[model samples]
Target: MMASRATARATGSFAAYTVSELTSLIRASLESAFGTIWVEGEISNFRLAPSGHTYLTLKDEVSGIRAVVFRGVGKRLGFCLENGLRVVCRGRLTVYEPRGDYQIIIDALEPKGIGARQLALEQLKARLADEGLFDTARKRALPSFPQQIGVVTSIAGAVVWDIIKVVHRRFPLADILIFPVTVQGQLAGRDIARMIRELNTQRTSDVLIVARGGGSAEDLRAFNEEQVARAIYQSRVPVISAVGHEIDYTVADLVADYRASTPSAAAEAATPALTELVNRLQSNHTRLAHSFSRLLQQWWAKVEALNVAGLDPQAVLQRYLQRVDELETRIGVCVMRNIDRVKEHVLGLCQGLGYCGPTKHTVRLVERVSHLTLRQDKQIVSFLETKSRAVESAGARLHALSPLAVLERGYAIARHWPSLKLLRAATDARVHDRVQLQLFNGCLLCKVQEVQQ
Candidate 1:
């Protein structure tokens, strides 16, 4: 027995298994050990591959484990997977043979509670709203005819393509300029702010859109940053916040000039519908033509109703006949009245001549006698002297009362310049005046040089 034991020990070795067999054994062991285990931890090292596979590390204070969800499982999750989010994941355990590392094949994940990113977004939105940045009254109206549209979004996102499509379809003439930016991850908020400032500096766009595709609250945290909110508030051009899904809102949305539910909606808001406008214009044209035609028809009917030539001949003949009758009657009455007046006037004239003939004859004889006497007695000097003395007395009285006589008596008269009234004293002088100086011989017009106090 001792010899047999020695020989067996020399030949004995552990049974070797193939790689696939070993991996399957390990996987079965792990599945049995942690079958459908639920783990609650903070997410870390999250990664999404081009193949639609998500890889991440879930950690707690005690331990952490690597985990992955294939495309089929990942697509079922309602919310985004992000770092530092508290989440509960259910999965089966398995071992990767090539790497010989144990991993959880996650079947499902749900928020353990509200995540930090979500809380941060909510707090920011509340603070901004309290400061009245979100007030509807402060919102600016979007331009109906925007010459250019500015977009602030990720350079590599599908949002830009969606916006371009909608805008091109609605208003092909509208000019669009994209301000490329990071819409997710760290420094995304800063990048968004910088893009907004740069667009403001250029001042080339009439309207600005801050847009991105729909994502979870954590994924859209950049839009809730204070820098992004302030940039939107301070923008001169009207800003449209089109950040996430319809139900998701951020501080950027509250502070923007307008808010659109999606990027496509933002494009629609910024542009006019060409097809609808063309249809409206055609409708108006048809209405205008119809109105004009109706008006022409009414005018033509009015013209046709009137008989211009048919009424003219009868109306003219009636007027002329009536005028001729009135003129004949007036002429006969005027002739009769004139004959009576002429007879009366002639009789009155004869009576007046007869009555004044005696006075006329006496005046004529007296005038003839006076002329003959005056001619015969040319040297009646005493009567002529008396008449001349009376005339001289009257002339002297008139000259003493006259203003010109007063001026001519060696007493100077000063007159107010504009009113032409005589100035009694120096006090009557004003600063602006053309004074008239009345001398004994003549008057002199002079401007006021100065006035004595």
Candidate 2:
């Protein structure tokens, strides 16, 4: 205490300044002297506090100064503060009373040579790319005919109207649902990401279109945000990104399943043209009808070429008649041969009796032979009558078994027209089908106007 007073006396003061008092005076002087000045330096030892304040060291070759980005200001900065990045920041010098040190309280900051938003977009793209969010294999195919399309964009903007107009013009059958969200400013990214997650949860749409009008990078900053990109990546529904013009590319564009040059183009891609679809259906129907007609014509031709005589009952009956005639002729020949043999044997027996002279014994022998001849003739006539009766009976049975007999009884056989398959029941022939009726004489082709159960 005595040495402190001695130092105070040597400096010509009644009392020494406390640490807090000195720090306060320095803070007031430094802040007043360099109020909102721009400084260009490379960032070092960059760290973010739990309170959202960023603490970093800004330095050149021979000098270094402490810098702090308050939460409010950091939120507005478009890029991340990283080590080794040369930046030009606008801020006022402020002394930290507790630490007895000074730092620049940054209000705005930018990269030394490039825009902050661009650099941030590039950085985020690289990060998400490393995680495979931008892989072509992970991309999904858009539904060719989406029934319902979910649109995430600003309701007040013209982009949404353009999409609605184009989609309705091309495919009036598709329905459009609008999800309103901010498309610019600091909170825009958060709003977009929230809506995307909500849309995925409900899954009401077949496909989604996240779009915005053409603008500068700052205006379209929401789409480049990491959260927005991730929300699109995780969406179950396929996403089509239509942000800015064709020349402008954002992180959302890279991560989406499809990218369109404009909102109108996105709508065109999401749905098919109504006229084209109708024409395609009509063409297919015509082709199917022609094919069916050609097949029916071919079947009809085959039926016409079929030989009806092969199924004729007269031909079958003629074969049976020829067989009967052959059997009758064979029986007649065998009967005549047996009669000749019997006559020869009777003559030989008469010669062996030695009746050469004209005597009573010879006359008696002649009488006996005459009696035997009459008896043999009676037996032959009975046998011939029995054989004729048997032949007639066989012919009657053969005629009874023939199909012509059934047809003659007024029973007709029905067969399918083209296929020639026999129809047993009424259901075998469909209504409006042609059928063939086989009668006793010939086949009759008739059309079945109706079918009975």
- For residues 104-147, write the lDDT of model 1, one tens digit per residue: 89997777876545555666677777888989998889998788
CA lDDT of each prediction against the hidden true structure = 0.86, 0.91
Task: Give a tens-digit lDDT track for model 2, residues 59-149.
Answer: 9999999999999999988677889999999988898887888888889899998988678877888888899999999899999989999
Once fitted onto the true fold, the runs of candidate 1 whose alpha carbons sit more than 4 angstroms away are 1-119, 308-453
Q: What are the per-model numbers of colliding residue pairs?
A: 0, 0
What lDDT score goes with residue 453 in model 1? 64
Could you tell me which residue pairs clash in candidate 2? Answer: none
How much RMSD separates candidate 2 from the native structure?
Answer: 40.5
TM-scores of the models, in the order given: 0.43, 0.53
Candidate 2, residue 20: how far the Cα is off, in Å: 12
The best candidate in terms of TM-score: 2
